[model samples]
Target: MNAILRGVRVIDPLGRLDAPGQDVWIDGGKILAIYHHIDAAGVPVVDLTPPDGVDPCVLCPGFIDLHVHLRQPGDDEAETLETGARAAAAGGFTHMVAMANTTPPIDTPERVAEARLAASNLPVSILQVAALTRGLDGEELVDIRKCVESGAVALGDDGRNSVSPRQLAIALAETAHLSRAVFVHPEDEEMIAQANGTQGSVTRSPIRPVETETRAVNLAVRALSHARSGHLHLQHLSSEGSVASLRRARHQGLAVSAEVTPHHLSMWLPVAEEPDPQALRKVNPPLRGELDRVALVQALREGLIEAVATDHAPHRAAEKSLAYDDAAPGMIGLETALATCITIGGMGGEWLATLVERLTVGPHRILGPASGVPEPRLRIGESATCTLFDPNAEWTVGETPLHSRSRNTPLIGARLRGTVLLTLAGGRVIHQDPARVPIVSEQVTSV
Candidate 1:
């Protein structure tokens, strides 16, 4: 349905528009025109103008998450593609990359097609990340060309980066012509095993030490130097050395881009020191200390780290209720990602434009400039995909019900600002929070 967003502040970083009091007209799944005023007699009208018209709600291109775990085709109890898509829309993401570490990993062309079928008609665009290896076993690369043909957006060995550097280089060289990237979860298996081996007992400190990630990053970067053409997209980088290695790689002109998770930026590892297990925070490539988080923020500010991706892994409550050592390593993230970044990581309105760009354009760049996904812009003929948010809106984390099937987030009781009010994909209002948004009217009136 066509809807005219009346008196909304448009934040279009690519178009270089930070204009207030604009009327954005959407029809036929595209932005028809953006004017100073529009009479909304033919369609519905969403009045975003605050009563006083000061510090009003903002409109930007629909958010995009480059990395997410939907757990479809394998674990529906954790999250289905439909539920994950709704959760993404509720979080203001119109598009997200679904990680392929499922029951049967998305490694073959047939599996990729199956995932596409599962994601059919979802609220969010499900761009499947095909596993680098046949089963994410770190050996035997998947048919990159075939998988892409079957609708795979990118390639990765999610949660498994201990693949032999030789094999990774070979796979990269083979798929170089495809122009699709291999997103790596940089973690050394030997280091983790060693960290646990040293502590024979079930209880262990630094299960996955800092060195595990840094060493893997170092190896991946070094190996990337030999790859033919394709870029190496690193996922969920948390350690200080990992950031430094990425920085050095960029300076050296290696085709590499990396993303940092919200949990890594805000929360630290409580499992190591706490007398009681903090199973909720237990994640793969485990969270580090304040020093690591400080460096991550510094790197992000310096433009060394280009994107912030919520490695939105969803696990069942029963699974999360187990002992720290036995409990699952991930929790739901899509619903609370923006607030977590804003409140916990201190990324507020001043950085809104940059934050929007990372979620929209930066992730798109990893797929390639010529990738078919439309650039998020506020121009006539552009797809009318937008996300409306109230930066100052306050709400408790868990109190606001998430759209996801699982409620495994750690930010249950934390109060947060920056709430998503509306999300439109292809001009369709896929998700709208009725509580926070103003009433839509048949007649439009300027504030």
Candidate 2:
């Protein structure tokens, strides 16, 4: 089967193509051709004439989250692979990396295989990251080669930082030998004593200081120096000083990349002062001051921040209802990431294009398929992965409209501008507006 996506603009940052009024053709799960017009008669076409009252929209490569916890095989009450992938598709995401912090921890080949099999049934792509140590205890290293062969993309102890520098060095060395990257959660546990919110004068709560992140980064960089084969990727960096340290490491020619979440870029810790703890403003690497927020935005604009990931960790209502110290450390982000990027991050069309590239191609280079810009017009002969969004459409978020099983999002009631009109993965329209006719799945394939 062949499908045509017509009358939509194409946006690819690396290719410098941000043009409108083109048609895309996908055949057998690969983009065959993209042009202003397709003359073939047998192929089915989906005419996407921009509604008269609505502004023009843009079509780009689907997003890929570098850090996510699907919580399958354990902790299903919070989220599962099937439900999480649905949430990812609703947010215009085509792929996501599942963190290694599962119930038993993804530390063995069998566990990695189980996760991949479970995720294979979903519409989107799910890549598992194996544990850096057995059971994530930071004691003994897992079988790096076997885990990678069993479908693990990388190795990491996502929830907890390794305790000993020697243990970390050994793991990095093994990963380097296997030609894989090691994703580090960059936090010095010693500094994490009862730290809840951001460390600043605006809040009376004692929060984890900036040194926690810097110390972990410095240690990871030094370990990389000894084991130079693998790259070090940092997750959810919040402080300005941490960014500076990463920039300096990159300047010195170390292989390093870092990601920032939307909550950190758009909100600050002052919101925690609200009387209602249920407001869902508090998060890990807790929201910083206005200064830190501005710095993070600047880093994104200046290329210091390589990617913007959701860290889409979901928790249940009961889990988030507890006191500040007792509540879980995450908020639902996959559903609202792009909207937050466009509305709050002040990203224009070009910047938005760059962000999409960072979310898809950039991360893909680090983990999965080789990096390359999605061709213009979204035609056939290319992988059938695309995201269609209304850039100027306005919508208010609420609990009833959210697709995630968990309703712990912080963006509820917030007026957002961009909206995902349709999302396709492997030539299948996993999510489409009910008002529009759905596209049939042409052909499906996965890595």
Candidate 3:
């Protein structure tokens, strides 16, 4: 399987170079050669000739999602490993970390092994986050070593906050000894009771104050202090104050990193109308105020937010239609993430490259196994994991066209700039523009 992606603009965040009119050759799922010029007679090539009169599209490393819910073995109605991987590949993501909140939670090493087996055939890499507690109950700690041995990338109780500080400390201590990171949801139960939406009078729902997140983070940080350089990752940080707390912790030499979601950066409370419970916009660590949104965007530009994750939680429409309090929190995000980064974040080519690195290399460093690393100008002998994007292209998101099993995206009907033209994983085009030519199914294979 030798093919040349010629005449494409290559953006390598690691190399910090954006060179246009280059050729990339991929063979056996690894890049064979990349250069500005290649003789046609020397080797087989496929002209990825740019569209007439249009500049070549950007070719960058595939994205890595730090947080996503691929409800497998339980709630397949919402999403499964296979479907979620397909959606991720189409969205230009080559790897994703699956959360630990599914039914029969990924608490044991056996369960983690099960997930890996289930996802073995997917085109997108699926990394499992083992539960921080047995059954994610926050009472009993799971076997950290066994879970890690079973293929869990990290440990977390994503959907629920660890209720017992003592238990959390023990878990952190054990994970630290094992050289594994712990991801905390960072929500104090008492504060979370009143804090559901942005804190302000504009929204009817009670605001989940900044204190809720900061307080929980403080606890986690304190717990980590007892351990041996335990890496603590704060998930879905939504407040300016939360970011400030993490910043100070890092300045003080704490092993802390954080991620922010697109919705938190893109939307604010106090809409003309209150968000419908069924809108899928209702999410945990609910959307914050405009000021927070602005601060988060600034943090991204300033490199305070280490990664941008979709927190791609999905639920059936019927499930989301419940009352505001009863409806589940989360929305489908894999597909809309890149578009939102371009459209709402007001980021262009260079920043987009950085974001892709953050999604790929940054998370990979934290989780290890080292999948994402900067490449040298798309040279030969490189891994064949790449994303082709049309930055200037525009498209409207609709429920009917989304690949997620759930149609729970708030961006539906929203006009978005930028579209993924093709995604190649292991020298195979898992997704391609159907309008251009019907991609043979034989060319597609699971990751």
Q: Once superposed on the true structure, which residue ranges of model 3 sit more than 4 Å away at CA?
A: 42-56, 194-207, 268-278, 370-379, 436-442
Task: Decide which is better by lDDT, 2 or 3.
Answer: 3
The CA lDDT at 179 in model 2 is: 64
Error of 3 at 294 (Å): 1.8
Q: Rank the candidates by lDDT, best first.
A: 1, 3, 2
Each prediction's whole-model lDDT (CA): 0.77, 0.74, 0.76
Q: Which candidate is the best by lDDT?
A: 1
Q: Which pairs clash in the backbone of model 3?
A: 31-381, 32-380, 33-380, 122-446, 122-447, 123-447, 195-207, 195-208
> Local error of candidate 2 at 349, Å?
3.8
Runs in model 1 with CA error above 4 Å?
27-29, 39-45, 50-54, 198-206, 268-277, 369-371, 436-447
Candidate 1 lDDT over 1-447, as tens digits, reads 477878878888888888878888777667887888888677777777777735667788888888898888788998888788888988989889898889888889999998888786776788888898887877688888899888888889887765788888887776677778888998887777777776322222337878888998988887788775668888898888898899899999889999888788777233113322367777877877888898987777666777888999888888777778777777678877787777676466577667777777777777775346778776688666888887778887667577788887666667777788878787667777666544432211110
Clashes of 2: 10
Better of 1 and 3 by TM-score: 1
Cα deviation at 194, candidate 1, in Å, is 0.7
Worst 10 contiguous positions by lDDT, candidate 3 = 197-206
Candidate 3 per-residue lDDT over residues 199-305, each given as its tens digit = 32212233457788789888888777766467888899888888888888888898888888878878722221344554467787887788888888778777777
Per-model TM-score, in order, reads 0.90, 0.87, 0.88
